[model samples]
Target: MENLHNDIYPAIDPSVTKSLHQPGKVVLITGAGRGLGRSIAEQYAYACVASIIICARTSTELDEVEASINKINSAVKVTKFQLDVTSETAVKQCFEAVKEKEGRLDVLVNNAGASLEWVSIDESEPGKWWNVMEVNLKGPYLLLQAFLPLLVETARSNNTVVDVVNISSIAALLTFPQSSAYQLSKAALLRLTEFVDVEYKDKGVNAVGLHPGGVVTKLSENNDAIRPYLIDTPALCGGFTVWLTKGARTWLGGRYAAVTWNVDKLLSMEEEIVKGDKLKVKLVV
Candidate 1:
């Protein structure tokens, strides 16, 4: 089972999946300018969502993404924001803007993340080492702070399940040398997911930590050691995310999911997962 992996399947395919279509739901995706974020945004459009809030630091990329969404589904209302997720002022403003315009948010994808050169702590530049935390960790924290209230409100009034997808990495489970910043941040994020789920499960908010498969992108190309594992594509991330939000997957709340896991198998193991409290961050005895 350790070596096994899976890819995209019909159940999660937004373009053809009937069960996964979100007709009236609004979704917000960070780092949507390109790569996996772009793919996730596109999948939502294909899922027939009512609107998509696409955010990134680059206006040009957002413009291109907006245009692409228009081509994919002109009916999808696309909103673009040139956002730097690490900036508190920007995140709060984004929250206010979304709250004002949409009045509610059904999905928030904390997909904006950063990484730094693999240098030992002793030799690492303080700014560079900590910047990764600011982007990968602090950004999501601020977003959560700013938007969670809206999510909770939406859930209470609408009586529906809202999702928060924190994009974690497989590295969170590894102990690779010189990869401390990214690993620790992701590991902490899983705990944050737990806190969010436990705190708001009764209110219909489901927070999930997801490990998107190793899809090679601009942010990842510089690393040579992990190059071979970059065999997956952005569609896998997008499709799996759709599946995660297809309905009220409360059983999966506060858990870790990977795109490489076969959805059918994953579903079949729900009983085992729930009974054993699996897919969570824990220490081995």
Candidate 2:
């Protein structure tokens, strides 16, 4: 709840902006080519992350991210890996490359996602659902399978913890009658994160699911249902991401961190606000 316009979204020259100054910690982000992915990469780079692996199907997009990150922090390492998460071989190779280059990974952000025209269960093509599942669910599954060893390796080497943040959606927690495939795919991912969290806590890898709310991105351009509520920005999402990483064990982990007010209220343990109870709140950046 920080001052959005002042502390968080103050206008500044991109040229003068610098990295976050967090050297020696590596972070791997999927779909780092555009939208939220690109923003998250920039934010992390600004934070001075030791190394950032920008993974995507487009070498050009990855290259753009790398250039942007390096421009902000030349000392930060930025590596690009072309990958199609739907392909198992590609996923394996990407992680192997990370291991070879970074030696250790401190964070993994599963932000790659896919969408299609709205379709109901009765009329939706099986292929459409399969495609959604493959990219949204199976992609993360493949990534976790391939890169989990490296996460563990990092933790064992540092004798600390690492994080895996799954980019889920409000649709995943709600009933989307039109886009059933997208909803189901994200819902499955939520369950997947839970499973990983429980299964790997002792291994030192913590996993959590997040919903960035409606944002003005390609994913929302054509989806009218979700477009209007899309008031959040990529930078805001990026900020929340870093915050979550810092407070993973205390404020997050094994829980859904959503931008939706209703979701937050529903999940809150505080008593319901009854007709203007003068609620106290804190500003967040």
RMSD for each of the candidates: 1.5, 6.6
Q: Pick by TM-score: which candidate is best? A: 1
Candidate 1, overall lDDT? 0.90
lDDT of each: 0.90, 0.75
Residue 165 in candidate 1 has what lDDT? 95
lDDT (tens digit, per residue) of candidate 1 on 126-218: 888888889988888999999999999999998899999999989888989988888888888888889989998888999999999998898
TM-score of each: 0.97, 0.84
Query: Candidate 2: where are CA atoms >4 Å away?
Result: 1-21, 247-251, 259-285
lDDT of 2 at 179: 84
- The sequence of per-residue lDDT tens digits that candidate 2 reaches over residues 1-285 is 432321123122122333224457799899889988998888786676788888989898888888888897788888888889899988888877788877888889999999998878888788877899999999999999988888988878888778898999878867778788898888888888878877876888878788875778877788887777777767766655665564235224455666333323333533443222212121345
